[model samples]
Target chain A: MKNLIKNFFAVEEVSAHCDGPCGVYDPADARIKAEAVLSMTKKILAMAAPDPSDAAAVVAYNNTMSRYIAIKEDQAHGTKTDILVLWTDFFKPQHLEATPDLHDKIWKATKLCSACKTTVSLESAEALMAAVEDIHNIFWAAKGRDVAYYTAS
Target chain B: MQKYPENAGFFEYVLLLLGRRKRIRVTGASMLPGLKDGDELFVDPYAYVATHPEEGDIVLAWHPREADLKIIKRVSMVLDNGCWLVGDNPAESTDSSQYGIFAFKRIVGKVTSRS
Candidate 1:
């Protein structure tokens, strides 16, 4: 029994499992990408010129689309990582206790981020922001004392 | 719990964990029915080095510009300039048609299992 107790106490705590509370993350990082996706969707819809028989338009359009895709991909992943960090590192048991639906909201947000590819529409991007806002609200509420200082500065 | 030697630094520990590719559960319905939204997938980081994927093979590729993100899609066409990729869903996916061909280096690993 003594050995068991000793072994349990000796266990090393795991670090780096979650992104800690540092005001380093920006919601704009995701917003910028979402905006780009929306713009690209509009471009695709508004393209009036016929598909160029010559290789030039094909090349240009392809290149632009490639860049857009890359940006969207980056944003989607960034949001995922950010949300994960918030859930694992930032949110505490008290926050969950206060906001009973926090878990569901986070899960739905993560799922929406992944499911964005389902449509080329901007709805996914909008949904992501909405979810992030909910989290931000809870996060700010959790730090009620700090909020005043943060805003004043 | 026995503690191993503490020589490994933070980055070293991270590399060790990331060094061995992990099989993660696929949680999106984009691939759908075939590779169900929540199916398990084995991602071998080194698989791309051994064999470049062919059409119809599902793959996980690094999202360009962000090293942490992974995007999974199927190869629709392999052109000399680049590979054309598209999601299984026609109306829903914004794949090669929307984004054009993904460069070869972006590819990470091909999905080995759905179970």
Candidate 2:
């Protein structure tokens, strides 16, 4: 009976899973996609004015916007993934202890990121960028670096 | 120095190495300028274990049929059903548009470092 109790209470070694923090986050991935979204918006607006007879331009504009929409969806997914990684792997218990607002900022950014997928608008894309910038701010703050300026359009 | 006759072997060493989340070097240009063709990269399997892959992050995934060939690409979009991935160099890459979004399980790890 004692042996059984000992077996039940055995201390097994817990394996470490994450490769300690290696700076890998890139905002360009999201920036380029957002720029594409903004450009598509401009194209759509330009094509809307002085209606072109070549229907091709309109079709092209529509296709470009569609692609941009797809890209936005992709960017949103990336943002969520990055946020999750930081929240789960990078932001240790020490981070929470250091910055109490970290959790709230991450949650807000994630929520805004999901919203980017549900709609197709420059404003929505901008909102997504804003959220990412917020995350970047928090990330830099956690790392004790001067918050890198991210100008999102 | 006293010799320990029954020490851990090579296979044990390899097992230990694989046991931890290790980074591997990406050797193809399929990912291009952003993650130069041949760059050392670290991966964190546990980081995105619970969450799904997102856009912009590079991921190492298995070839759906082959399983042996590991492909690396930037995530373009993630749907409830699958994830859309693309190579940085569109000119010479076969990606989500060609094969459709892939099942999430195929992803091995997220690239965490590059040098």
Candidate 3:
């Protein structure tokens, strides 16, 4: 059955492990998600703790906090996904040689992404941004692009 | 003694009948610039039976990871341990480096001719 299917597909070789070489790579994806995580973290921290005696104030506070947390978690995961795809599909051995710390940088950045998801600390979110910036610089350098780094602040 | 020129066709037919020669359609881009996808290849199953495969020879072998998967790759080097197969298009191919050495027993044939 396998041989029959192999013959049916008859594709001599897979050019790439993923979708071949589509030449579509953008660090901007990671950047956008990382930015969102940072923004949500800031928003959550800035939001006031609702008055314990006021029922309506407490409900509003709970709703805002939940919404911000949800966005932060979603965007943190998105950043991880974006970075993983680039690491696996776009970046190659040559890129590694060019940027010796590429693996370590990505590892730290992904861990920070997870940290942001787990906690609502501004420090964790800022660290995530810094790690993403490192990745962004390396990505553009690999591509020979001269994109400048800018922050939401 | 008679010259075998007149029996050339007969000899080839016998080889085919005996499963010494085979025809398989090439399917991948690993050997691009030399062989294209969908190209038909005439394989000499006996090419490496008596002698070792030489470097640059395109061969059909079972994939190292998947025994049932037949892969066509070029012999990059004849190693003391095993033959090292590499694809013509290195950027696009996942060769011995990714899958490990291909055993001689796994090699089915040497691609003698292609169209």
* Cα-based TM-score, every candidate: 0.42, 0.41, 0.53
- Candidate 1 chain A weakest ten by summed lDDT: A11-20
Top-TM-score candidate index: 3
TM-score of 1: 0.42
Q: Give the DockQ ranking, best first.
A: 3, 2, 1
* CAPRI accuracy category, model 2: incorrect
Q: Which candidate number maximizes lDDT?
A: 3
What local lDDT does model 1 show for residue A139?
Answer: 72
Cα lDDT tens digits for candidate 3, A1-153? 323322333223322221235347788888888999989999998998977999999999999899999999999999999998888867877789899888898888899989999998889888888888888899899889999988665
Q: For every model in order, what is the iRMS?
A: 14.8, 16.1, 8.1
| Candidate 1 residue lDDT tens string, A25-96 | 444444454445455545544555537796888888777766766666666766777777767755656677
Candidate 1 lDDT, tens digit per residue, B60-107? 765544457566678887777657876564333445665677888877
Task: Give the higher-TM-score candidate: 2 or 3.
Answer: 3
Runs with alpha carbons beyond 4 Å of true place in candidate 2: A1-55, B1-115
Distance from true position, residue A118, model 1, in Å? 5.3
Cα RMSD (Å) per model?
19.0, 17.2, 12.2
